[model samples]
Target: MKIFNAEKIKELDKLTIEKQQITSLDLMERAALQAFLWLVNHFQDKKTVYHIFCGDGNNGGDGLVIARLLKQNYFDVHVYIVPFNENFSIVFNSNLGRLKECNLEYEVISEATEFPNIGENHIIIDAIFGIGLTRELAGWIQKLIQKINYHQSFKVSIDVPSGLFLDKKTTIAIHSDVVLTFQFPKLAFYLPDNENFIAEIVLLPIDLDVKSIESIPSTYYYTDLNKIKKRYKPISKFSHKGTQGHALLIGGCFGKIGAMVLASQAALRSGCGLATVFVPKCGYEIMQTATPEAMVITDENYHKITNIEFNFQPKAIGIGMGIGQDDETTQAFHHFLKTIPFRW
Candidate 1:
């Protein structure tokens, strides 16, 4: 799965609409239908109520379509439109008109209106904001998200969490139990900093243009099992220890030799034919005693590493686990860097 930024995703949507010769309304309906099907499959209990919060943009259009589909399927549905702005998208107006035709219950939230009562029995569908958001949420919008999070209901976000930004650090965001994103996963969803805002993500395919996805350039990507399996090579039956590659693990002060010991052990476990560890003179007996399978080398300094010397070159080098920034150790690191052919 490829991770796309906000602009690239918007471009994908535009190119999809143009190349597929489909109206934006039809595309919104497709995304809404996919979300509805997913909800139906996951929420088997028919008695549960669904409270959908929509905005005045295309994301809100998605919520309106979902509400209509849920009503057709005989599910209890409640729709609320967050009146964040006076202007509304054409597709959103079309969906709102279609929703009103069915006589389903719906309301528009304003300054004078009270927030809806939500409980744990109700599932909250958030469509307030999507990836196009470029500013921080304020006023009642922030309070509304806080209220939604306070309800402790099972929340699902449409396309993205209501207030989360795709490219920057998120300050205020909706706490969702799951996110149903269209097309590709957003870059913010994969970052560790946004883990609290993003939960289990479901990539909802809206049938966007494949050529657009392939043609778009991105610096990030999502890896899967198939991609990882393709990178490994099977070992031959006639292979020998010397034929396999060797690995050198370098790092360790007098009191922190355990770091080097663990690194050498990991190198051996990772199928490196030969594993060697370099430490200070004080750690010589410790490394040799703890790991007899690994070859041990010690620097001339007793308490800290001053230099690294070896008769033969290893296939790969691992450094800087427990190496402290002592003056001697720093010079030794510089010397090692200058001696190695590979760039760090």
Candidate 2:
């Protein structure tokens, strides 16, 4: 899956709306429906109470739509509107109107004191903020997030955890057990800096325009089974050992022979036809004993790799597993790179 930044995601959304000839409201409904389906599928118990915290934005609109769907289906649902500011998105107000039409009541939390006590048995759906959040949250809203985080309830965030920025780092955000994001995975979700705020990220496809998604330029991608299957090649029945492929693993110093053994074993296990390891003299016996399936070549040096020599060319070479930074070893590696037939 192509991972897009915030601006690129907006661009993709705009392109999708234009190409599909659907109104933005229609798109929002699609997103809300997807999220609602996921919730219903996972939590089959209609008696379970769901407290949905929403903002005055499209993300909050998603929560409102979900609440309406749940209530209409006889599921117990409670909606809270957490307006970070007085301004409200047009679609949000539209969804709010729809909620009222269904005779479903909602509460607007104006202060931190108005925050309800979420029980551990209940489910909290966080829709207060999405990827568009650009500034750090503070004051009562931050306090509300902290209150939600303190609860042991199963928290599911919509699009992204509240207060999370897609293109930048944020100090405070909703720590969710699951994040049901729309269409593509956000780049911020994978950053180590934001790990504390995120858990299992579920991608909910809203049927955005595929042509537009592919047309958008992106350097990041989330590799899943589908991607792997697309690139996989089947082996022929007539194929032999030499027909597969040759892999060269070059590493291992004095006490790090285990590294080379594991590398060579992995090479063969990954369907490599031939596996070879080049190590120092000390590692020669250890590598041979541990990995009998691999072909081992030893360096002239005793404890380090000062020289690397191989006759036949390998289809791929993996180096620097456990190679130490000795002066001679470094110089030998440089020389070996210079002698390779291929350009770097």
On residues 98-156, what C-alpha lDDT tens digit does candidate 1 reach at each position?
99888897988866667798877799999999888888776888888888888878999
**Highest TM-score: which candidate?**
2
| Per-candidate TM-score against the hidden true structure | 0.91, 0.93
Q: In candidate 2, what are the lDDT values of residues 1-344, reduced to their tens digit? A: 89888788788889889989998889999998999999999999888899999999888988998999998998888899998867899989999999999999999987735678678999999999877788777588888998899899999999999988887768888999999999998888889999989989999999989988878788998999988999989999999889999999999999988989888999999999999999999998898899988999988888999888888888999999899899999998999888786642
- Model 2 TM-score on a 0 to 1 scale: 0.93
Which pairs of residues clash in candidate 1, taking residues 3 or more apart in a chain or in different chains? none
Which regions of candidate 1 are displaced past 4 Å? 236-244, 342-344
lDDT of each: 0.88, 0.90
Q: How many residue pairs clash in each candidate?
A: 0, 0
Best by lDDT: 2
Cα error of candidate 2 at position 294, Å: 1.3
